[model samples]
Target: MNRRSLLAIAASAACLLSMGLAHAADQDTLAAIREAKTIRVALEFGRPPWGFKDDKLKMSGSDMEAAELLASDLGVKLEIVEVTGPNRIPFLQTRKADVVLSTFSITPERLKVIDFSAPYASAVQIVGAPKSLPLKSEADLKGKRVGVTRATTGDVELTKKAKDFGVEVVRFDDESTNMTALASGQVDIVIQEPATLTAVAARNPQRQLEPKFIFTQFPVGIGLRKNDPALKSYLDQWVKTHMADGKLNAIYRKYHGTDLPAEIVKPTN
Candidate 1:
């Protein structure tokens, strides 16, 4: 080959090699986790059913169980990284955690910031109030004080409609506080996950809290950084396999007192 042609070929090869390395650097989350031999899973210890601490002060919840299984499947040690509703995505964005399994609802708004695996669990946002409150519809919420955990799906969804419904939105830093507000009558109603509302009712039966209306139903997934195709793909497959084998459902039933929705167990997409 001519000297000029040989020189051109060498330059092109170098450029291609550099490009490949840059791409790999951008998408090495899975590789990095494997190399470190540990997966840091962000979870909300204050959110029950999904995540919380037991009486022994040890982490114990469905999300905790799922995180353990994920690490075991990947053959890595599991490291729990405590996160809250507001900061879960930020933790993933800042690489503070390898993945977030903190009852992260997959919404279009959230999808804009981070990628997610297929739905691993399903949840619903609801408005709950005392049974005698006569809240039969959204219109009945007019002028009512509604409590919600800041940045949670229920908060986001309720806030968007609060103005139209004439609802007074009261935000709390966490689910525990939100529930407290309702039980204490600081808020006339609350928007939260059904499981949380149920928990609150069980603890404060005199409050007579009952679901007023379902705001929205959504699927939850493992939150990952955007552009990490390898990590996203691996988690998607992991969720599918576990769902098919009933392991995921078993965990759901263990905490939820019922099986996961069929659509979530066998998602069409």
Candidate 2:
């Protein structure tokens, strides 16, 4: 090429490099974790095999195990924060956590605000039907009462489709109330993610709450702030590497085979 052309190309390259750095520069979420050598992740401590403390008061579960690996890969120590469905996104937005390593799902609407890693697991939606309820099919649920956690996708799905399914919907603020209302016949069924319900059933084996109906299935992913693509990539790569090597499956099997928990493994898309 000519000397003038080479000079122009070099000048353009310098400008582009500066713009890229401005955009990709680590945010506070990653910077703090990098400096401290620990990734602070949000988890739902209420559920076992995810984040609930063990008998010795230690964070124990597949999510906990998974996040621990992720921290190590980033060359950092681990810091965990407890979070729930509603607050998961807000926590990432405010940099409360570097990434929500909890069982967060990827949704189109949510992606407008938070970027998500590639899915790690599928979050299946199912129902807990009491034997007394004659909910043999979707048709039988007509005019019947159903309970779901407030602000959860289960709530959105049931509320939108209830009238057509011949059901009325009631939402509870917490999982305890949702399950309790269903057991008492106040609601015909309670809707929740299959993994969580699996954990619940394991905790209360004395009561058999069969999942009679499954309505929706979606992949679970880590949530990150819009600009935090670096963190998203870190999580995605970690999941991919471990899953391919069978480490993820081994963890799932160990917990799933015991009273500690069972998993509702969602179909990966």
lDDT of 1 by residue, 1-269 (tens): 99999999999999999999997886789999999999999999888888988889999999999999999999999999999899998899888999999899999899999999999999888889898899878788888888889998888888888899888889999989888889988987888888888999999999999998888888999999988989998999999999989999999999988999989997776
How far residue 195's Cα lies from its native spot in candidate 1, in Å, is 1.9
Which candidate ranks first by lDDT, i.e. highest?
A: 1
Give the alpha-carbon lDDT of every model.
0.91, 0.71
**lDDT accuracy of residue 76 in candidate 2:** 83
| TM-score per candidate | 0.91, 0.77
TM-score of 2: 0.77
* Model 1 alpha-carbon miss at residue 183, Å: 1.4
- How many residue pairs clash in each candidate at the backbone level? 0, 4
Error of 2 at 180 (Å): 3.5
